[model samples]
Structures are given as C-alpha cells and as structure tokens.
Target: MPALASDVTVITITRRRPEILLRRCVPATGRQTRPVDHLIVVDDCPGTAERLSAAEGVVWHHASRTPDDMSGPGRSSRLRNWAARQVSTPWIAYLDDDNEWQPRHIETLIEAATAAGADAVHSERNVFHADGRPWLEPIWPWSADDAEGRSLYREMVRLGVAEPGRNVIHDRVDPLDIADGIRMVDTNEWLLRRDVLLELPFTETLTDVHEQGLLGEDDLLLADLVNAGVRISSSRTASVDYYLGGYSNNRLRHQDPDFAWR
Candidate 1:
C-alpha cells in the first residue's frame, strides 16, 4: 500500500519555464501513485504565477527576485527554502521543473524511508539528452563509478550508512564520512523529513569564486546533511528521469566546447 497522501508534500522549483512546467513536470507529478498532500510550485520568475492554472490543486508562490536578477549565488536554494517553509507535512520531496518522476517515485521513497526509519531516502536517476537520447554514460568529475566515487561509497558504508539492499537502518550517519571527493546526489531524487531538512537547510551563499562554473546547490546541501549526521537510505531503482537540456545544471554543451548541439 502507498503512503497516505496527507503525510507528504511535493515542491517544484521553476524559473520562467512555464512550457516545461506545464507539459512535462505537471503530468508526471499528477500521475504519482501515492498523491501528495500539497503540490507547491515556487516560481522565481515574477508575474509567472498568474499564468499558471489552478485547477490541478497546485499551490503556487512567486519569488521576489527572478534567477537572472539575483546578483550572487544560491538563487535556487533560496527559492526552495522559501517554498519549504510553506509545507505542513512531515515528509517533503522535490522535483525539478525540467525533470520528471515515475508514478511510483514517491511511493518507493516513502516506503523505503518508513521501513528503514530513516530521515531521508534517495533513488537512482536516469539521465537523458535534450533530443531524447540516453545519457547514461557518467560524466567525469561527477560519475559515481570512478575511483573517487568508490572511496566515497566505501566511506559511507564504513561510517554506518545502511545498505539499501539489506533493508537495514542506521541510527545516524557519520559526519566524517563526507569527504571532499564525495559524489553528490541530486536533490530531485531524494525524500527528506521536514524537521531534519529545516535544521540543515541548503547553503544560500556561494563560497566558490568562479562565476560561470558555479557548483550545484544540491552538492552543497548533501555535504551539509552528511556533516549534520542525518541518516540516509538509498535505492538502486531509477525512479526519476533527469533531462539534460540547454538550461540544465551541468550545461552539457557548455561544459564540452566541442560538443554539437542538435
């Protein structure tokens, strides 16, 4: 049986991508097997909320500043944190504007977390290129199968991180397990408890000097969670589909100068 819809809240953060929001994200979220109590959309684009349809039981909020207007880093983090404050459920799940979730995404995460008594649960994510081509080949520096990735996962296990295969639950995750070379997990693929999440909110400040090559907000948040000793569970099942569009975080084409854009 799926978890109660009243126990979970889904939040989607978007900025000026109404077409993607309406066409892709909305349908996926709406089709979830275990419906959420509240579906909140944090629109970072000013005046875009007025254009969103209200017939889908979606509660919309407009951010004071658009992503382009923000001077420093953490625009996405700030928007997500703001939207999180509006949630009243015990569990919260995030979905990106361009990405999508399988019908059992929430159901799987909630079930796993509940069964393991964990504060957070994460599932695998399948990546796809803009033209609907599979992008499963892990990109360097971020691929979890690399040498650094093996070390990070080993450290996680050494520090009492529960193995999803065994369905075991650990009381707390060790902070020291989070090394500098650790592979970061995507926020869209995880479900977190509301209280624990609020205690270790996403960092809204950018310490990195590079402007164009700014690191991901999800990476920072995951580091914070690890440092805070939050217990996290993982499922190998790919329940989320991440689209690599021009506006994606990795910016595939931009990162690879020689890559062709079709």
Candidate 2:
C-alpha cells in the first residue's frame, strides 16, 4: 500500500444528495482553519463518483454494493476506514451526507484537544428540520462544573446524544470500541485515531439496529470505546449543524423538552 498522505483527513460517506454534499458540505469543510488533506466522498449511490469529482478537495471511493440500512449499517464506518486508510494523517474526522460543520468546527476540536489532554474529544451540534424549521438550538451543556453538565444517563433519559453520529476526535489507541451494545457517544462529531479505526471496523450487526424505532449504531460504538478504557472528553466548543432531511422521518418519542437545555 502507498504511504498515507500527510495532513488531517475529513471523510464523508454520501448517497444521492450530491448537490448538498458537494456544494454545501464540502465547501464549508474546505474553509476549515486546519486545511483538510482530502475529502473522501464514499459514493453510496451508483455511479456517483464521477459527479462527485466536481468538488475541489474530494477523493471519491465506491462500495461494491449499496448498503441495506442507509441510516448506519457499516456505511459510515466502511467509508471512514476506506478513506482513512489512504491518508497518513494522525487524525480523521467523519461527516455524514446531510451534515455540515461550522468553519471553526475543526479548529475548535484541535483547540479542545490541546487544552483537555484527552485521547478523544467530541463537540456538540445544532439540528435543523428540512423545511427550514429551527428543530433545535445547541442542546449539550457547556459548563466547567461537571455537576451542571448533562450526564450520559440524563441524555439517555431525554434521548439527546446516543448515536455514534455526532462529531468526535481521537488519537492512536490499539483497538477502537466500535462494537459495544450501549452507546454514549456520537461518531459524526468524533475525531479518531486513524490507525485504530483501520484495525477495528464498525459492527455491521449493530449498524442500523432498531431500539424503540431509533438507530443505535453510534451508541453501540461508544459503549465499545468506553469499555476499551479510552479517555473521551466532550465540550461544546466544537459543533456542527445536523440537517434533518425529509427522508429521515423517524419520530422522536419526545421533541419539545428534548430540545430545551439549561
């Protein structure tokens, strides 16, 4: 295999929404303070790589077949691994088809990593509905007092952040916990150790598994991470906008109180 390229890699696994992924999401990432080495666009759509080539920082990859569960089933993990394996960066960031980071998102993650002395650091997010509705304000707590911050139990009770779908940053640890059953982290916002992720792939069995009708791949991944004794620190400084597309019609048991945070 060729030596992995130098620089941070921002990997995106996309299907159908080429316009949004390439035009909006990719460009926004292009503006990051830490210039991305490559934007790996894993084309989940048939023959979408050619069109995806139009984006500036994109390096397109294709899977042999389409995934059974679009929500999670090995899609993000497979894409991240495939893209990450090519780049020799110490850090790898994941973004989904519909999500976009703020320009400062990467910078913020880098800053938080430097400050906390953490092996992995994850940021919070703002969510939006497809019809331009303000679905949520930033929901995670942001106080130095751990007492004031929402614990995993509180988030689970309210159903805020469980999926491996949020942003995260991680450094090199021998094996990554991508397969545990209970998830307390979101992978979309995660920065991971490129080498570790390359070794332990996401659990296809856990991907898109239904828990009261909600997908639980991300949650399971976190449970695995914590079990591995990896140090994870979370703060609100790094954040992203989770665009709720029309296709994602899964309803939350509660929405109003879930959006309200102290």
Candidate 3:
C-alpha cells in the first residue's frame, strides 16, 4: 500500500559519465524503499544512450546538443528542466551526475511530507569527498514543523542557509514581503511535487556563465519557492551521499567548482 500511495519519478541529469551512471545512480534507484514509476536520465552528451541504457529499468532522453551546444552548468540545468516535463508522476526527485541516493531516500521524503502537511519536502545531504572522505553530515538541518523554521529573515541571518550573494543558494522569500507563506529548501536534497515544480523553472541566464562563474541558482530557486507560499518540510530520513572529488592532474576528469553543480 505504501508503494502505491505515490508515484515517484527520478530525473537524473547527466553528461559524459556513463560509467558512474551505471555503477552508482542506476543501482541506487533499484534499491529504493518505494516504487519508482520511472527513471529518466537525460543524456546531454551525444551518442551516450546505449551506455546509459546498459542499466536495467532505465529510460534515456538523449539530446544531441544543449541549448547552445554548450557545456557547463546551463547544460545540466536545461536538461533537468526538460526531463521534469517528461515525467507523469506527481513527485519528482533530482540526482546529480556524481551523487547517488540511499535506499530509503524517496520513500522517506514521501512519508515525511505527507505527514507534515507540506506541499514540498527536503532533507540533509551527507557530503563525501572523492578520496571517500567524510566532510560533514546533514549539510543543512532545519526544524520539522513549518512554524518553527518559516522565517526567511531568521534563517538567512543565523543559519546562513540562503547565501544569495554567492548565488549557490537562493531564498524564495520576496524582498519586500517577509511572510509570503511559501516554503524553501535545498534543491539537491529534496523531492518536489510535479505540478509545483513545473511552475518554477530554472534560470537559463545563470547557465551561460564562464566555467568558474559562481551562482547559487539552486539556493535562489528554493528561497523563491518558500517565499511564494509553498510549504517546505525537512527530514533526516531522506538523504543523499554527495561525492566530493579533489583536483587531480587529469584535466579531463578534474572535479572542480567548474564541473561542480549549483
């Protein structure tokens, strides 16, 4: 019954990391605690569908060229917004190129949001370095009840949650109105309602920056959502393990902020 309660669709935006897609992201969904309606992997790279499809229970959305045949944050963000449109489920969960989800991640988010009477839900991310080192746990911890963690000013001032200046995190709160009644969250660690997400599209302008351009599109998106009256809920149960890699000699595969996502 729990499995049939909601249809969860995972939108994994990827480029030329087929091996990681098959080895990590693919298997992670198979181990999900709830039923996954579909797994859509948007292959922004050319001629990579066969490789991405090697994994079972996977559907591929291969795009020959990005919005401008470009490579960078915009490419991934464009693909993510596209894939979100293809899903028929009521819920959508996003996973990055290098990150993978835990077995109970989706199910936990579903249960938490449903129980908390929230329109959207997000949780902590367990950060892991490329050398397999643990940097921190529960990257951002917030209260369970909306009333407790609802103030945009309070959160921005103390928690340093929405660093709008950095553009890494955006608060949905309106600059003029403090009490918009919407909820905000960490995009990497959340599951969103399908209908609600369709209304909030990622910015294409931010995607066109240089390789190392700093922008908190994700943070800004969440802040805007919360400020718009979307109820945000946080939980410890729903989480993902993010791989943090060091800059190596290999320029082709060096994991830096240039390749790191928003």
Candidate 4:
C-alpha cells in the first residue's frame, strides 16, 4: 500500500443525521488541539458522502454494506469494521456522530499511548444533556438491589474497579476488568493501533451475533484486546463529551438514576 499519511485517523460512523454530522461531529474533530491528520466519516447512506461535503480534513466513505449487515445483528460493529479497513493511518480513533471530543482528546490519547508504549489507549467521558447541560452525576454507582446492575457491580468490584458502596470508575480502566464493568469503555473514548484492530477486528458483541437485547461492542472489543495481551493505556480524564439521547442512552431512557451514568 501507499505510505501512510498520518499517525491517527479519526473515524465517525454516521447514518442520515446530516445535521449532527455536519454541525457537531465534524466541527469538533476539526478543532482538535493536535490538528487531526485524517478524519474518515463512514456513512451508511449511499449518497451521504457527496451530500455532506464536510470540512477539508474529513474523508467521507460510504459503506456499501451487504443485506445481512443491514438487516442482521451488530450493524454498528459491522459498519465500523468496514470503515476501519479503509483507514490509511497508523492509529484509528472513533468519534460517534452524536458525540464531541474535547480539544485535547486526540492529543492526550497520543501522549498516553506513546508514554506507555501501548497498542491502545482510552480516555474518560462525562455525561451531558442533548442540549449541552452536564448531568448532575458524571458517574454513578450500580445499585445493589437491581439484579442486572447488581451483577455488573459485583463484577466491577471483583475486578477492583469499584468498592462496596463506592462508585469508583473515575479515571482508571483495567482492560481485563472493563468488559464486566457496565458502560465503562465507550467506542468514542478509544484510540487504538490500526493494525492491531484490523488483525483482531470487531469480532465480538452483536456485530454478527444476536443476543437478547445485549448491545456492547465496546466491551467485547476490550475483552478481546485484554485476552490478546494488548498493552492498553488510559488517559484517566474526561476528554469526550458524551451527550445524552444517543443509542444507549435513548434505549435506557426509562430507567432510574442510572440514566446518564450507565
């Protein structure tokens, strides 16, 4: 292949949300502190690449997905996997269409990866309302009563992520334990080696399997990396603005205090 142009290529997977893709996601990536070398926005819509006409740095690539990819499970992972294959950079970072990164997000991740000599790095994200208001609880503890949340909480505790009566997922993330910790490793918060991700691929999660209402490609990917002994690092600070009303948040819109933090 031709020589890679840059160290990191940010990937934003968008659908028909031209307004958000053009207005929020693209602009946020454009304003990064380190000046992104490449930005590839993968759109499922056929003509969205030409229609978006995004900023200069953005390379809009339309995913001509197969029928199974569209109608079957793991559409998110499938689309992301396809886009990642087209990356021409050494590193690949993800920023979903509904989210925005802090100016130092990419810069911070690169520093962390270099310092730790790691294959992948992750950062923190605080919850914000769709209208730009930060949520009261940046991170919340899993309740001991709810069976599902209880299991998740116990697993986190076993992994040393949280303690009894203490919601401890503030900055640190142990790759081996992050998968069991509920809603911890988000796709938007990761910066991984392009070759590493491609070799492992987004094979786990719902990308190809159909679980009963189980959706966590991020967690599955983390599990795979940990299993493969990938050297993962953490920035340990909130660098991404995780806006509410996205896929995960909207699905749990009816829940209790765990709404935003979960």
Whichever of 2 and 4 has more lDDT, that candidate is 4
Q: Write the per-residue lDDT of candidate 2 for residues 105-149, one digit (tens) a residue.
A: 887877777787765667776656654455432332222224433
Off by more than 4 A, model 2: 1-6, 44-47, 66-72, 136-183, 207-215, 246-262
> Deviation in angstroms for 245 in model 2?
3.3
- Tens digits of per-residue lDDT, candidate 3, 91-175, equal 8887766767788888788888998887778776554555556643323223333454346335554544433222123323233
Q: Is candidate 2 or candidate 3 better by TM-score?
A: 3
lDDT at position 190, candidate 4? 94
Give all TM-scores, in the order shown: 0.73, 0.68, 0.70, 0.75
22-106 in candidate 1: lDDT tens per residue? Answer: 7777788788898775454544565457657554566676666533455223666776787677767898888877778889989
lDDT of 3: 0.60
Which candidate number has the best lDDT? 4
lDDT of 3 at 227: 55
Pairwise TM-score winner, candidates 1 and 4: 4
Model 4 lDDT at residue 213: 39
Query: Best to worst by lDDT, what's the order?
Result: 4, 1, 3, 2
Query: What would the TM-score be for candidate 1 when compared with the true structure?
Result: 0.73
Best candidate (score: TM-score) = 4
